[model samples]
Target: MDIHHLITKLREKGHKITPQRLAICELVLSSKDHPTADQIYKKLKQKFPTISLATVYQTLHLLKDLGLLLELGFPDCSARFDPNISPHIHIICLKCGKIEDYETENLKEQWAKIVKDIGVEPIIQRLDLYIYCDKCKKNQ
Candidate 1:
């Protein structure tokens, strides 16, 4: 996503476009991995020495509330942020803690069928799968 798009979104939502918030959004957008707040803070701190972890958390939560990001939670792990807000699946490596996003037409079809059969409009949905990564499997 373009930085300009995010800036426009903040403007539309009547949010102040602070430099720190912009940096957080840019980091999330550019990151390939779903990053936790600490990871984001660590990266941003290198450039923004005064950035606080609390500020990062607040910004992330605000972005999520605005429907611009997805927050992923795992047992025994800090919640991670995803810039792709659309529905998708997450595959997590149980050993190395690696996470990747997956998509399939079958899942979408099944989701539609389930929602239709239940006769209830859904607000949100998520699917997560955990497995050992290739390197972990090889080691095992």
Candidate 2:
């Protein structure tokens, strides 16, 4: 979602639109590179020096709760946020901590079919493939 639409949604939900909140929204949504909460805090700190990391975490959680984004979290890893909430696999670079989305629209359709065939409902859906991304592979 674009910043305007996200901000409007927040407003409709009675959320206060502070400059900091706006910055966070724009930063997260506009980012193609999935960013961890710490990464966001550091980038934002460059401009909003007083902004707390807790605030970034809270905003990220709020976005996730509202289905505006998806969180890619793993044991012993900082959670990375992806605004492209469509069905896809996250290719994580183990060495550099980079994340790239691998679109799987057809996979979603096939998955739905399989679920229906089995007569089961899914409670959660996420796909992540951890690997040394090309650059990391080259380094290795």
Candidate 3:
């Protein structure tokens, strides 16, 4: 995502664009792997010595509330943030903690059906599949 576009959107939402928030946005935009709040804080701390963990959490929540991020939740792990806001499937490796994003027409249809059955419009829909990665399966 373009930094300028993000700034413009934030401004349009009545949010003040601060350096810390901008840095967080950049990190999320550039990240290929979904990162947890602690991971984001650690990366930001290298350049911003005084950046607090609380600030990172708050910024993440703010971004999520603004529909700029997707929060991935797992039963046994911390929630990770994804910058890709589009409808997609998350294939997660249960053993190695690897997460991969994929898109399938079949799943999209199924999701649509489920949503229709529920009779409510959702802001976002999440679909996750958990399995061991190839390496982990081979190791076992």
Candidate 4:
């Protein structure tokens, strides 16, 4: 992801893209790994030694509030961050703790049908499918 484009988008959205925020945005947007606030902070701190952990936490919340990031929940205590806002599913590797995003357009249709049949509105805030990935399973 181009950091300049991200900065431009944030500015266009009326978000003040501070230097620290820009760094955080660059880190989160460019990452394929669904990292936590602490993980982001630790990596970012290497480049920007002055940045604080509290700032990282605040930036995470700000990006989430702006709909540029998603908070993924799991049985594990920490929340994970995802940059993709499009409807998708996450497959969590139980052993390695890796989160991979998958897009299945048909799943939405199936969900819609299920909701219609059940006569209930679906609160599809996020979807996470937990499984032991092949590598993890093989290691066992």
Candidate 5:
């Protein structure tokens, strides 16, 4: 989690990076789990008790708009924020509510072909392929 580089990148995008916003960015980038704004607020509270939930939400949205974060879908509820914006799939555990990243490069061509055949330009949206992981299956 290189805060300096992230700040520089945000500055390059003409986004002002305040210290509060930087703290929020640090929390997101350092996190492995795709956390919601509330989750981020809870963690940030430890160090920055005065930081408001609305601020966290605004920062997350801003970062997502800048293409530096991914807004992941939730089948049951609110969206989750992911720092990794790179093209990849995600698997969510139904029981424990765990989120894991799944990387595959083979799907690019297939997706492109599908878009071509459909004759509609499709923006390759964030892939969320839900499946029971090995641990979840074993528990089941």
Candidate 6:
């Protein structure tokens, strides 16, 4: 979702509109890196010197509750948030912790078949493929 839509939703929910909150929303929604809350706090703290990590966490959680992003959790690592909530695959680099999105029509078709065969209703669908990125592979 874009900044304007986000702001409107916040307003509808009776949330206060703050510049810091706007910055946090822009920072998270503008990138595809799927940064963790700590990463976002560290980066924004540079711009808004007085910004607190708690603020970043709160904003992120608020957006999450609004269903505007997807949160991916990894073992022994900080959870990464993705603004692109479409059904797709997340390729994570085991070596560098890089996250990339991948989507294929074949996979979508297969998933539909699986659901039809099982005859079970589903709410959330996600697939994460863990692998090393080309740069990380070269380094290794």
lDDT of 1 at 63: 84
Q: Model 5 Cα displacement at 10 (Å)?
A: 4.1
lDDT of each: 0.86, 0.84, 0.87, 0.81, 0.79, 0.87
Model 1 bad stretches (over 4 Å): none
| Better-scoring candidate (lDDT), 1 or 6 | 6
Model 4, span 1-140: residue lDDT tens: 46776677778878887788888988897787899999999998878899998999888887787677888766767788888876678888888889998877797777667668989764445777889999988889
Candidate 6: tens digits of C-alpha lDDT, residues 1-140? 66788899999999998999999999898879999998999988888999998999899999888988778877886799998876788888999999988878887788888888999977666788889889988988
- Clashes in model 3: which pairs? none
Q: Candidate 6: where are CA atoms >4 Å away?
A: 116-123
Model 2 regions lying over 4 Å from their true place: 120-123
Tell me the tens digit of each residue's lDDT in model 5 across 54-75: 9998999888877778887676
For model 2, the run of ten residues with the poorest summed lDDT: 120-129
Worst 10 residues of 3 by lDDT: 103-112
Q: Write the per-residue lDDT of candidate 1 for residues 1-140, one digit (tens) a residue.
A: 68897788889989898898899988887786999999999988988899999999988988888777888877786798988776678899989889898987887898889889999977657778999999999999
The TM-score measured for candidate 2 stands at 0.87
lDDT of 3 by residue, 1-140 (tens): 58898899889989898899899988987786898899999999989999999989888888888788998887876799998887788889989888889987786788788889999998877878899999999999
At residue 54, candidate 5 shows an lDDT of 95
Alpha-carbon deviation at 133 in model 4, angstroms? 1.2
Every candidate's CA RMSD: 1.7, 1.9, 2.1, 3.0, 2.8, 1.9
Clashes per candidate, residues 3 or more apart or on different chains: 0, 0, 0, 0, 0, 0
